[model samples]
Target: MSCQRGQYVTAAVVTAGAISGAYYAYRWYQENATKIPEQWTQVGTLKDIYAYPVKSCGPVIMNKAELSILGLKDGWLRDRFLMVVDEKNNFVTARAYPEMLLVHPSVKSSVLTLKHADMEPVHVNLAEVVTNQCAKTARVWGVEVPVFDCGHETSEWISRILDKSSNNFRLVYYASHGARTLRAGTSKIYRFTKNDTGALPDEVPFNLVNQASVDDLNTRLKETQVTPRNFRPNFVMKGGKAYDEDNWKFVKIGDNVFEIIKPCFRCILTTIDPETGVRNVNADPLETLKTYRQSTEPAARRSAGSSPRMGVQMSLRSAPGGLVKLDDPIYVA
Candidate 1:
């Protein structure tokens, strides 16, 4: 009877160990499974390239851009290389002042010209001030980044256009910094490699959107039409299904390659009109987007209240540069 009891106890222990091992193996699979795309397909053609020299301001449409991990090199400089901040060095964006959308920027011969409806155009020579020795720290997404102040003349000029009581808003340019460490609060999914670098962008160096996604959103709307400008994507592509960008792991445009890092989370800024800077009051697209496009991924969702994704953020995989042109075939790799 004692020998028989020992055999029974030994069998039970083996069974319990087998069950525990199986459970942990399944858990490990679930955690790492999302890293690669389940399917890859030829999606579209690169339709446009838009660069915003000043963050949250108008875009300068382009026919081509030199793709780089640092940012889109358009000869003049990189996108979001310059920014507008308040007196306290807090980043000022279209979310706070819808009028910011009215400020249009164009670059030619290394000169950045700012044009608005109600004010005279202001021009800043990029080559002249890009190397200014003085630097001050500014905040973007709670990150204290050092930037070169464009001087009081530029500040006064921007203030006049916005009709501010004081010249509190200043235009500052990024001087150079080594590889920026992603903040602790940032999602691990968007974490950068040791070689990754960044400028003054909200997150990634490039934002790409699909024209089909915009068309799909327009079909659901009965009130107004929204353009690619409202979303402020650096690269706009066409020919793919709406939201096809979400499934892309590796993509090639022209001769350059990029890694689709994350889906962009829509915010209240999308509700503001890109032309007039007036926000939609009756049927905001964000409100409608929340109905169908809400993401299950915590990192993909901007906040508990925001809607689904409209675009994707990407980083260059092929570097030091290659020219990506309009109508270039985009392939999933």
Candidate 2:
């Protein structure tokens, strides 16, 4: 607490002070430099760069996106964005008609637009897109799912959009369980298309990364080579190596905090190229992850939080919470 900048300080005094400072530095390194076990990297953060508005549609780049309890941004344009519902039984889009890709869709305000090569912006009100005056529970991704209908006009409008010289084209409503706990079977049971299962809309998990992990992964792959987008992550970190967040029980970023309860299980979704909507069941980034990142496979045939988790998609606490900007520091309290 007292000034000792002058040569008046004795040689012994200076030596002692230097030793104390070195000791403190060593202690600081010990506290901050240690990496999480099975994770040889430091902590890192990943900012959501692009928001895919309509599921499997297009990516909407955001200046900022809110972090919610479920990782689903409250007012996010990508939150519960677009869904391809089966015209036959009120199901969502999937592999039934792979040509559904030919059907492009967009949304603005309370209206959603569905169009294809020859189709026009078929406007349907979000509030009245379909009407069944009833509820239906269907199996999706091997799980039971319940959804409600929009009403009459919306249904008629959707039918009109896909009905042009079309006999098997129709529209339905998809009730999304945004950012729920990781339930592989549940997700795989809810059907969107014939072979396609439902998604937990806002359900991507938060896989913590550290600086050391980034350095190591980069040492092997280099650059932002293996990207978080590959995992469709809702959060990311660049300051460390991959898989650096293995042992974290909880983490907070900016003003949002999330519980790191379990390892997120991986699925074939990561194999699908979000850009081209192409599917390659093997020889993917997952191959690299499998070499290092696959979590302990579950005991039973299926379980929640038992799959290979890559990121944490927290449940939305507030509708479109607030903005989680780029480079925001994530703190593990």
Error of 1 at 122 (Å): 1.3
Most accurate candidate by lDDT: 1
Over the stretch 78-138, how does candidate 2's per-residue lDDT look in tens digits? 3433443554443443333333434455546545565555444566655443221244543
Tens digits of per-residue lDDT for model 1 on 1-333?
121110101334445434543453344334323343334466899998988889888888888887644578676656888888888998889898888888988888768888888778888876556443366788888778777777777799887766564597899887553334565566666645533435777777888889999999999988988988888998888998998777777777876677777777888999999989899995478887888888887655544346668898777665445798899988875
> Candidate 2, after superposition: displacement of residue 77 in Å?
3.0
- Candidate 1 to native Cα RMSD, angstroms: 17.4
Per-model TM against the reference: 0.83, 0.57
In model 1, the Cα lDDT at residue 297 comes to 71
